[model samples]
Target: MIRRANPADEATIRDCAEQAYRRYVPIIGRKPAPMVVDFAAQIKAGHVHVAVDGDTFQGFIVFFPKGDHMLLENVAVLPSAAGRGIGRSLIGFCEEQARRGGFTAVRLYTNEKMVENLTLYPRLGYAEVARRTEHGFSRVYFEKIIGGPGA
Candidate 1:
């Protein structure tokens, strides 16, 4: 089950992020990046959501409202839950939220080294809008226009 995340889930979200991102870091060759946002800060910003399986918190996604678009911040699923569709569910949640807010599109960025998402996003209807080198990494930016509530 996926639900809105609150400050109380900060530690769990952070732990999940540490494990998932540690695995990702090796492939990208980057130092560890924090998985969870500053709990208090994001809760105030209201952009964090959590994915739970019974009592286990499996993953989380964060996106920020930017004018008419939603900016995907981060989405992390524990390595143990990687193939169970948790990541997809979290993304669906984001889309639902965007549609409800009447957002025109959802935008996000991923490094070229992350082959899984490079393939997954396009397959899921995301289109590459731009590519560039930033912070020593080759980043691909994507956007999916959400065509209203029924779309």
Candidate 2:
């Protein structure tokens, strides 16, 4: 199941992100953005959700609606829980929520050093929109149009 994350889930959520993104720290030469995210602030804004199995938190996705699309800010899953479809489910949750909010698309950005995401996002139907160095990190941006043109 997936539901809005509350204050109680903050620790689990941060742990999950830390574990998931830890491998990339060496690759990126620093902790990735997700590692330093302020979950307390995110939760306070109601922009976080967690995927659960029974009583366990499997993963989380953070997002918010933008003018033309939902910005999928971050997504992380327990590496031990990989292949359980938690990541995709969280993304689907975000997309469905965006559709309900009348957004025509979803946008997301990731570090270019994360090769897995480059292939994964395209396989999931998100097309590359741009790539640039931002905040000293080489970032790749992607977007998926979920609604008709000119919505």
Among all candidates shown, the one with the greatest TM-score = 2
* Best model per lDDT: 2
Off by over 4 Å in 1: 32-39
For model 2, residues 26-96, the per-residue Cα lDDT tens digits are 99999999999899999999999999999988999999988878999999999989998889999988888
Q: What is the lDDT of every predicted structure here? A: 0.83, 0.93
Estimate the TM-score of every prediction: 0.88, 0.96
- Which residue pairs clash in candidate 2? none
Question: Model 1 over residues 49-110: C-alpha lDDT tens digits?
Answer: 89988988889898988877989878989888889999999998898888887887999998
- After superposition, the stretches of candidate 2 with alpha carbons farther than 4 Å from their true spots are 148-151
**Would you give me the overall lDDT of model 1?**
0.83
Task: lDDT for model 2, please.
Answer: 0.93
lDDT of 2 at 38: 96
Pairs clashing in candidate 1?
Answer: none
Per-residue lDDT, model 1, residue 90, is: 91
